[model samples]
Target chain A: MAPKLGIVAGSGGLPAKLAEKCRETGRPYFVLAIEGEADPATVAGAPHAWVRLGAAGTGIKLLKEQGVVELIMAGALKRPSLASLRPDWRAAKLYAKVGLRALGDDGLLSAVIKELESEGFTLVGVDSVLTDAVATEGCYGRHRPDAQAEVDIAHGFRVVDALGVLDIGQSAVVQQGVVLGVEAIEGTDALMRRCGTLRREGPGGVLVKAKKPQQERRADLPTIGPQTVDLAHQAGLRGIAIEAGGSLVIDRDEVAARADRLGLFVIGCRKPS
Target chain B: MAPKLGIVAGSGGLPAKLAEKCRETGRPYFVLAIEGEADPATVAGAPHAWVRLGAAGTGIKLLKEQGVVELIMAGALKRPSLASLRPDWRAAKLYAKVGLRALGDDGLLSAVIKELESEGFTLVGVDSVLTDAVATEGCYGRHRPDAQAEVDIAHGFRVVDALGVLDIGQSAVVQQGVVLGVEAIEGTDALMRRCGTLRREGPGGVLVKAKKPQQERRADLPTIGPQTVDLAHQAGLRGIAIEAGGSLVIDRDEVAARADRLGLFVIGCRKPS
Candidate 1:
């Protein structure tokens, strides 16, 4: 009997990609799609069940019934307001244990992961199932960062890294040595849009993305895709830099081709440990 | 002979207010306004001359001819783009001495101050002229910060203090220990507007303003006015906290009245040394 894999899917195409990879590799898998977050079309014609964000107990029950032992969490779960959630018995118990300390996304996710592990489920990282989605180090487009852009990239990485340490954000726009913008609750796209407004008639800035130092890699890894390239270009940025092996580059070939077409460089940077 | 006061006026009513105070006190003063920056209406019918931003030598020459030895720099001077500035010999010399280190506004101002002092001008702080404008400690409205608002105020101060250490900006919006936004190149009003957009339906955030740790107090001091109270109300904020004796409260009575009317608190806090 094949070992069953269970995907606790959220929003975006990563969930579908993971499911497809499992099918192609002849692995039996089921998706527990989060309602209002995961697209139903992504898991169409597959063994899946829909559950609300706070229905951890029900999801575990369904997975156990399917004899699933391995679990993978993929895609984004937009932070919902506390008023909006109706947590089931398991989620309620979990929240009671974590208490107010679980206010941050990382804290809540960590608590959930601990509970799942205690329940005997082995969690796997999405990158392990979709290796090609992980960004490789170095430039991937026809246009590479010029000397000035290189300086901006380095500065942007420092700013983003500092921001990550504070757990405030993971992206920043930097030109020369001045930080033009920093992301907070507004998210990356909004930050890029702001950089667009602040752009002057000169060498543009660089958008740097990196994972938080204490981030749970298996649950949520920083990701970029074709839309990111477009947004960066629209923001008049020279390039994009992501932490190598720590960020997901969705539709890599398309992202590279778009970067080439837009004359923007996409590089993977490795911050020194 | 009484040494004449030189007013290096920038935009905003602060310059006008300072000039008026000097006039009322029977102190001789001359205003050297920056072209393309200061409002002509602010210095209307006053002893004033306009010099382009980069023509620092010409400005000093005018002040010397007026026998202005004591200089006061006031008002908001939006950092102009590099290409827009047309530096004269003196300005060029100052920039060469400062080199690329003058990228931030504080850096450029510091360099300018050094040059002025070297040339025998005694720079004075605006607070020396407008003593009543300085904010005093304690709450100044019908309402005071509740326990949660006090916590948010403390958190806001810490965030702004950290940002100041980085010399980024001097304003931050905080709610329940979470920083909603921090001002960068976007300025405080924009940060407030962003907080307005990010505000949740609850006991809103607090706007904290403070002087940078290394800030040259004689040149730039954080300021809040009646408009700030209106904006805070519009943003659904519970209160505004400013460093006591380190910030200017323009239209103080009106600001307090407005805050009281809007059920918001205007507090002057003293961050311990």
Candidate 2:
């Protein structure tokens, strides 16, 4: 018998894409959507149940009922306010065990993974199901980065590495050896918009997205899609670069097509030696 | 006879305040205002001349004619667009000597200082004329930062230090061991407004401003004033902490009074050992 997969869906198009992949592969799966985070329309017509963000116990119970022993988390969940949380007994216990108050998003996710594993649910990475989406090293579009952009890419990598260590962010906008902006709580889209406003008349910067050096790679890998290419072009940036084999290049062909049309370079850079 | 002083005025109330101090002391001085940067009203009734940002030759010639030997630069000047600049022979020579294209604001300022000194102008620090505006080490408001705010302050200092090394901006907002924002070219006021939008229900972060580790201190020292306190309070921050001796606390009494009334702490922190 084939293994039954479970997707703990959050916001954005990733969850929908994952569900479509499951359908195409003739695989059995279930979707557990978090209220206010996962779009109901995206998971419609699928085996799904809605649970609050803090209802870890409730989510597990629903998954078990549907015979879900293997799971993957998908999409982004903006960190919710403390007052909005309604943690159940299981979540409360886990929080106490992990000392959740002191941990950042990565720490909290790590603790949650450990807790779920202890409950006998095996966690699988999203890439296992969406293998084709993974980015490969080298340029994907018609345009290639010039020498200046290459230098910027190297500088951006170092910056993102340092930021990862502090668990601050995974993206940086750099132009001509100067860092234009570093993303914190604001998402990539907002960061790109701000960079657009700050662009000078000359050649623009590159948007480099990489996994945090210490990031738990099973989930939360850096991702870019066609929209990302559009945003970069709109921001007057010359190119978009992501970590090779460490980021998802969603809609790869479309992303390449868009980049070519926009005269932007989309390259997957190798991690610095 | 006291050496006649020259004020290289930029935009902001600081130039006006410096003029007031010169008047109070009955000192002989001249203000060489940048055409688009400094307001004419600020230096009214004083010996002043308007010159474009690129007119370094004209400025130096005027200062020499007025018998000005000592000079201090005041206020902020947003970097001008290339199209707006009309670099004369002197400015062009200075730029070529300094390789100004590769430098950030501080590096350019340092090169300018060296060039001015080489031309026989003694560059004095703004603090020499506005000693009262320099922040002293200690708390100045009724409210002291709670233990958490103190920790945030220490963390903020480290963040700012790292940022300073990169020639990034000199301010950071941190809360609960997480950095909420880091200021880049957008500057302090804009940074504070963004932080206000990111604040949650819990205790807010503290704003820490410090000089870059390698900053040329004769000009461009970090500064805060009554308006800074207001912005911090509006951002829901617990307090404002600045580098003592390295930062200017303009309108000291007014800042303290505002902080006290707003239940915020205004502290001048000693540099970490």
Candidate 3:
């Protein structure tokens, strides 16, 4: 029997791609796709079932039924509206055990992993299989940062990197040498829109996105794509600096094409010492 | 000779009031006020000379000229547009040694204090003189928190406190348990306004302001007053939660009056565990 794996699919095509890669490697895998978030096309390409994000126990039971002993998480259930769906007994018990720290995505996922592991499923990192797709250092789009924006980028990168190291946030909206906004749970797109209304002047804005030092790299990896570039353009943000190798650039070719057309500077920055 | 204290005045009446209190105690003092930010009333009330916020060398020289010995920071400063401020030789040199971290208010002030102490002048905290004025726990305005808002406030308080603990920021904008913004150098008003747009579709937001656990109490106590409440109302925020006795409620009566009229929740939270 080929080695079996399970994929916890969130939003986007990444999970579908991962499944295809698994097929190429001749590994039989099962996918637990999040309802309303996972792409239908992606689900159709793999052996999968639709489930609510909060119903972790059901997901694990299905995986167990399929003889899956290992799991990989891909994408994210975008701004998961957790207001409606009720958790099952396994999820409720897991919630009671995890308490306050379990409020955020990181905590919620870690708790789910622990529960699955206790049930004899060994969770594998998505990166262990998708290493080649991770981002790389240097200019990624047609536009290179001008000297002034480069200086702002360097300064902004340092500030956002420190913010990330503290695990307070991942992205900061900076113009010139001053920070206008730090992305908390609201995320980057919301931050850019905030900037558009704040300072009517200044040379648009520079956005810095970096990975936290303590962040789990495989799950919830910081990502950028054409949508991000488009959002930045709409919100008047001129540039973005993302950590190389530690961040994911979804649809690299399309994202670069969009960045190029928009004349936006999208550079992959290495972590500063 | 009467005991002399130093006042590092920023942008309001608090510095002058603190100076008057010093005089009442028969303590002679020197006031180093920020030129563009300090109220003219503050300048008139204290024995002072004004200098730009970033002009560290000039500020140090003036304080020394006034025979200043101990320092206490009071009031607030208009956060300088760092992109425009031309740092003098002294400030630039300090930046070379300290880098971007030195740009934050606490970092810069601490650096200044270190330099002053090296020259034999001691630094005193504002709390040493204004302890009686610190706001204690409980309600201040017409609105008491609904159970849901209280839950959100508790969640907001924890997140804001964590932000402070990391020295990432001292204020956060929250709504329904989601953090909408975290303060960087942008300050509270900017953070509130940013959140207003982000949460426009939902209920209004909450502003949680607190001092960092490691922050110097005397030099930079968090403050809120009528204008702060007014700004929150203007930005569509529903409530304000500040740490009790860790902050100052400037013009307390006026703040209460405004909060009452606006139907806003303004309360000092019990010092967090």
Candidate 4:
């Protein structure tokens, strides 16, 4: 029999979807739902352990007890400060050893992944489980990016690349040959809402997301879904462009159908270099 | 005597200050007050004519009639869409000739400058008109950036430098090793307001403004003033940094006093090579 798989759940439906997949495949899986982050409903019928984000060694102990030899971290967690984190003793010890001067989000995540790996649990990537979650190149649905949108999408990619080098956020919105906004700590939702007010009078903006150059590839990739399409539509955007092979699309069919219904284009473009 | 000075006044106190300076220096000057932009009080008691932003040939005619030879564009003008701009025949002609693909703010400004230059007018930078307006190195008031703030400030500069090559906006805020936000077409005030909601738990972010690499030097410069300080304070920012010699600091004394009262720092630093 395969080793028991552990899902470290945070916010959003990705974790729930992963759990449902395991149930359908008849694989034994356990969830470690993070308090104040993961939805309780996601863990309602699954064998799970509840813990705060700051539970370091204790969290590992719970997984070990459940015979979880393989782990998959899914969903989103906001970057919290050390004070807000309220890390336990083991967590505090790990942070001390990170020795990061410019403490980036990716750096903290890398440290966490290292600690998990040292405990003898193999980190299974999302692609290894949910095969279709990975984005691929080409137009997604009924609509397509016009010539104007292509220009804006190109600009957005350039902005993301420059920002990625500095460990900044991964998304940017460009419209009618002008940058509307770039995502930072505020995340993609806020970026869209803010850009809504800043939209120009021509064709609408395109939202582009890429993997931050400094991101831990095994831990996370940029993600988009039905909510992303909804946000883009509400923000008066004409389309969405995510980096193919470097981003995850939750429920591709649902995302495409939503984009079609809302009169928007959703495409996965190859990152320029 | 200096050439007959023509002040193309937009929004804010900078235009009024410039007009007052001309009065104090006894330089013959005419103010081209932009309707719906320049405060009426600013052009009061000054030789002036009102014009819409789209007034091109007629505006130049008015300036020439006033015997004005040197033009100083002052204050802020929000970027306008061509549809809303209602461009006159001459203005439309210039826009058509520019042929910009990814039409950045700087590219449009450069085109405008060339049009005026070809019309036999000399465009002077803000530094030349208001000698004290240009930013200088060092802290302006009571606060110096702490070690953390300094790191953020450095990060902010890097963000601006990266954004500059693409002709994006010149200001960004960083705190606790994270980029809070970047200025785009929405301008600095909106950037501050949005970032206020995104501020982290530790020390406040620092606002950094630099000249976009492709900006038109003889026409405009990145600017800050007492109002900039107020915005930063309201946004929970701790300090302000501007590129020395490349950014304008309106009413420097008043700005320092306001920053000090608000418990914020305002400094100017050299742009990193």
Candidate 5:
């Protein structure tokens, strides 16, 4: 029998969708919803507990009490700061240990994953549960990338690779052979919207996303959904290119249909090793 | 006597400042003020001709007519587009030849430099005329980068170096070991303002500027002025770091004085070759 799962929900509908998947499969799941970040509806009908991000000690205790041996962290959360998080004793110790020693968010996440494993919980990636979430190499919709867009996608990847080498960002926008913007702490969503206004008159931009070179796969794989298609179209973009097998496509069919409806190409390129 | 300098002025005070230097030094010069971008004050009392950016043919004609033998391009200009520029016959020819093949703005600039040389004209960097414009290695003000700021500045350079590898941009903002933002089509001022809101708690960010790896130094060297110090301060940044010997710091005294007054460190770093 599969061990009962702990959904460490943060924000977005992915957690809810994961819960629904577990319910359909008759797999018992308990949600440890992060206070403030996790959408409330994620725990509406689930056996769960709300815990402040800073109070990981209590969260761990609750998960153990609920008999959750398998864990999956979902959705997005801000990079925690001492002032913003007000870490409890356990969290404080972790923060002090990892936060100072790490150079980037991925380092801190790796530390967290190690801590969770040492606590006897085996952490799983979201894609393991939502099998269809993993993106593969191919054009997903009716629209295909033109020669110019193909070049731009290549350019975008080079830029993303450079950013990742610094452990900086996973996405970049390229239009007419010019890098329009890069995702930093602002995120892919804002990066797309900002690049929208910066586009030149020629071929529209391409939104390219990939995992950082040193990113912790179990913690954060780059992700896009139908909403990403909408944002791309709104940003006057011509296509979307994500690292194949290194990124997630939430609701793939919906994303392809949306991209088709918006006259945009959605292709997955193999990320260089 | 100084080879009859031709100032191909773009937008901003740099062109005007360069013109003033020529006037003060009693060097014969002519200003080829671009139609839409060059500030009027730049040529208010100088030997100048207003020419559409698309009318490069006419500008070249006027430069020869004025006996202009040496040229210097100064200040900032948007990356031109066919729709926005409405290229003239000669400009159209040049654009058609260079636009499609170049991967980025620097490539286009390099081609333009080659074209000017083919036409028997010499091009010079901004630092040549404005002797004090060249930034050299050192902390320029009362404040020095603290240990944390020093680390962030080093981190910022890694980000900038990665950006340069792709010919992306000249600047990036990093705070507490995290990249806050990078400049692309949005320019440096906007990059700083955008980064201000994205900064993490603890130490403020540092603005780092460097030339692209294959940049056309004579055409578009990385530059900063007193206004940059103001922007850095307003962005809640602790300091400014620019590539020493590879970037220009206009009005060095003013930049230093302003940085001192604002309690910000303005350092020139030795760029890695």
Candidate 6:
């Protein structure tokens, strides 16, 4: 008999990989994968149940029924369609506890964590199982930012860090010496689109993304992947820098290959001076 | 004939009023208004010239031709259009002279001011004309934020000020304890739309718009009014706070009346605790 862990899975391959890692480590895990967000293959080797993100409370109930002790949350939850999230009685109660006109990504996650902890389900970090996934410091790929792009990267990193410190946002767009855009709840993708729509040479800026300095662990972390790289290439961005070890690098090889082909510099950046 | 001052105008009626005050105080002023931003009437009384925002050289030339001794930059410039600004030789030269990539707003403006002074225009502050137009400390409307909203406002003010210090932005969208959006080049109106689109309910949230603590006084001063109030109502924001004396209050009658009708509190927010 192996130690049983509970997995709250979101969309993407990360959930599947996490489940595989648990099995390989001789830990039997019960996965509650979000419908549409999680890969269909997430539960093939693991005892798993399908759950919609809107029904997260129900997932917790299922995990509890499986006699799981520690819960590991992994992957990305599709942002809930506010109009469609039909909260069950348990979810409704959780909602009542979060009193506000709106909840930011961090606020909502913290509230959810509190609710789970109060219920006797111990929460664990998403990366606790896969430590090697965090990108190393310095440039990750073969291509590096050009002299001008490097300057923009430095500028973008500082602006993004400033936004993070204010707990407002953690992404910024910079070109030459001017900022093209800053990310808010609309996310990095939208910010790229706006920069493209607003500027003619569109993808000529640099995009920097990072986690807020004071963000609670075991919650939302900055993430990037092939799509992000593709979007940057499409938006005419010259380069991108993500904080080393603090962000999820999904399909790093594919992202790097895309960057190489597009002549865009994609690297794990350090703290800008 | 009165001594002429140069009124560098951007958006809204603040430029108009600044010009009116200069006239009332017996000074003939040359108004240099950004074509798409200024109220035509604000410059109608003065010897005014229209210049596109990115054309710093044209702005300088206009003031110089009018024999203007003192320059007063009032109102807000649309964040320079990254996609469409067509700069002349002077603006190109000015851009070259000020080449730091991540320089904050004050840094950029100081560069612009230094260039203008080098060319001999004396930049002045709006307080020299109508001191009453400067906001004072206190809640300006009928509704004071309830305890929760007050906490939100205080937190939001701190966040906005931190952002100001880094020159990332100056406004934030706060609801309860969460920040939904922070103003960048897109400005407050766009941030309001992002909040409204993301979380479509509640009596409304709090919007804190402040001037950067170390901003160049003669440059654009943050201003709010009826349109802002209307935007708040449409976006479901409960209130707004502008910095006292550090901002401009334009079209007060309409703004206050609209706010009262909408049950939205429009306050003159001070520096945070």
Those runs of model 2 whose alpha carbons end farther than 4 Å from true positions after fitting are A100-102, B39-41, B80-86, B100-102
lDDT of 2 by residue, B1-273 (tens): 558989999876688888888888888889999887898898788779999989999999999999999999888765553445668999989878876443567887898999999989999988988988888899987889887788889878887887777676789888666677787667788788888987766788899999998988887788888999899989989999999989898888899899999999999999976
Candidate 5 local lDDT, residue A12: 72
Q: 1 or 6, which is superior by lDDT? A: 1
Residue-level lDDT of model 4, residues A170-237, one tens digit each, is 89999878888887778888899988888867678899999987677766678899999999999999
TM-score of 2: 0.91
Per-residue CA lDDT of model 1 for B108-192, tens digit only, reads 7787888899999999889988999999999887789998788878877776776676666788887655567777778788888
Second chain of candidate 4: TM-score?
0.96
Q: TM-score for all predictions?
A: 0.89, 0.91, 0.66, 0.94, 0.95, 0.85
- Candidate 2's clash total is 0
Best by TM-score: 5
State which candidate has the highest DockQ: 4
* Local accuracy of candidate 6 as per-residue lDDT tens digits, A74-156: 76554453435677777777777885334556676788888888888888876676676665676656778777677778777
Model 5 reaches what TM-score against the true structure? 0.95
The TM-score obtained for chain B by all candidates, in the order given, is 0.95, 0.95, 0.84, 0.96, 0.96, 0.88
Residue B4's lDDT in candidate 3 = 79
Interface RMSD of each: 3.0, 3.0, 5.2, 1.6, 2.0, 4.6
lDDT of 3 by residue, B159-197 (tens): 766666545567877665556678875677777766666
Model 6 lDDT per residue over B79-127, tens place: 5533466768888777667764455567878787888888877777776
* Stretches of candidate 4 exceeding 4 Å from the true structure: none
Which sections of candidate 6 miss by over 4 Å? A10-13, A16-28, A33-58, A76-122, A130-132, A200-203, B20-26, B35-46, B52-58, B78-93
lDDT of candidate 2 at residue A34, scale 0 to 100: 86
Model 2, native contacts kept = 0.18
* DockQ scores for all predicted structures: 0.36, 0.37, 0.19, 0.64, 0.58, 0.28
Give the better candidate number (1 or 3) by lDDT.
1
Q: Rank candidates, DockQ, best first.
A: 4, 5, 2, 1, 6, 3
